[model samples]
Target: MRDVAVISFSQLLVDKAEANDAELVMPVVREALGRAGLQKQDIGFTCSGSSDFLTGMPFSFVGALDAVGPWPPIEESHVEMDGAWALYEAWVRLQHGDIDTALVYAFGRSTLGPIEDILALQLDPYYEAPMWPDATSLAALQARALLDSGRLSDSDKKKATAEPPKIVDGAAAVVLASGDRARKLCSRPAFISGIDHRIESHLLGVRDLSHSVSTEIAAKHAGCFEKSPTFAELHAPYSAQELILCDALKLDKQVTINPSGGAQNNNAVMVAGLIRIGEAATRVSNREADCALAHASSGPCLQQNLICMLEARA
Candidate 1:
């Protein structure tokens, strides 16, 4: 397999943003490209992640292309899911051997609408969506199950200190390069040693919410169990979910989890996952961590999960 590494990353998070999506993405994209010592036209491919549900407008991501300088026309793709998926797509594109570099970004303004209501739409239309259970409520169900299962004691739960996720507007971008180009772009590129994603049964009733089986499967496929990472950036919006992820990945106390505060600090829907990845990449790029684990998730009750193992080049 061709080696792919994250060369540069940039992000912005705020309680709310007065600027539109394109405006929110422009500066971060510029910063990421600039840090990689490249220009807009120099990019080989571009992919973004966002949702139209927040804006109540279809094809909302199309407008964000203004930030990537689409004037000269560039190869691009978009995912309705989180930006981490877009990064995955970019990594796959790099494996084609024709492209040496790619740009990946994601932006979301959860404050634009009732985020809980928007998230509830991800549930099954026939069963869950009709009931309109908010994201927090669903997460609470998982927490309750975990508590009852004896995995999370009152003290353990209290230690984690579950906090209501902050609904914020944010944008994050990362630059990816292949092999030698990665070395040229950044002194210590965060190479993607392994990455994979998995989804459990959509019917939340059949699956065990107390633990993330999907995360474990994804972690196993991503080689997360091969070696321990010094840092772990998990996209768990709830403290209980974080606990579940730590258990699923078998991370020990030595692993520093969410040094950037994770999604609970700033949950911007589609953007937060990419921010976790960017944070992990930045830690590796700066030599703060020799190996790192970055995780992203979507759907209700941690139904979908992605794990990316990053390591600093020798």
Candidate 2:
């Protein structure tokens, strides 16, 4: 596989975005490209992540494409999932050796609708959706299970409870390039050493709510535990979820967690996961950490997890 690195990253998070999805996305896209010293045409491929459910309209992502200026007709794709998955697709595309550079982005406006009720629709339509359990309640079930498992200390539970949840509006973008192309775009690139993603059983009843088996599997596959990370950017929307991820990833006390204040402090639906990756990449590029582990999750209570390990060139 060819060496790929994240050369540039940019994000915008706020209580609410006054602009539309396209308007909110354009600035971050421009900033990411500008930082990489590239333009729209310079990007060989573009991938985005967003959800039509949040927009309460079909093909909402299509409107956001205008922000990227498909005019010259750039190759592009969109994922209904988070932007971290879009980044994953871009990484795979770059591996084909045809494209040296790609642009990945995600955006979300939680204020568009009743976000909790919308997320409830993601559950099993027959078994769970009929019950209409909101996202927070679903997550609380997992948290209660974890607390009952005796995996976390009382202090951990208390700490988690103390942090209030903050869901914001945001957009994030990242520029990726391979080998020589990556080296040319930035003085320091956060080279992707390993990356993997895994998912748990969709039925919450069948899975172990206390532990993230999927996260552990992905982290193992991504070589996250081969060496302790200086820090981790975990896409944990709740404090309790952070504890669960830390345990699953086997991070030590020495590792700093959530230097960006995490999703609990500034959760932005689909955008938060991509921001985790961008935050970790920035740390690597800035030489704040020789190596970092970034994580993203989708579904209720960490049902799907993606882990990425990044290292700065020696």
lDDT of 2 at 72: 76
Pairing residues by index, what is the TM-score of model 2? 0.98
**Could you give candidate 2's per-residue lDDT for residues 173-259 as a string of tens digits?**
999999999998999999998899999888999998889999999999988878668989999987788999999998889999999
lDDT of 1 by residue, 1-314 (tens): 79999999999998989999999999999999999999988899999999999878998899898888786889999999899999999999999999899999999988999898888899889987999988888888888778777766667777443456988999999999999999987999999999999999989899888889989999999999996799999999999889889999999989999999989989988999898899998999898998999999999889999999999877
RMSD of 2: 1.1
Give all candidate RMSDs, comma-separated: 1.1, 1.1
What does the lDDT read for residue 146 in candidate 2?
81
Cα deviation at 250, candidate 2, in Å, is 0.3
Error of 1 at 175 (Å): 0.4
Whole-model Cα lDDT of every candidate shown, in order? 0.91, 0.91
What TM-score would each prediction reach against the true structure? Answer: 0.98, 0.98
Which regions of candidate 2 deviate over 4 angstroms? 160-164
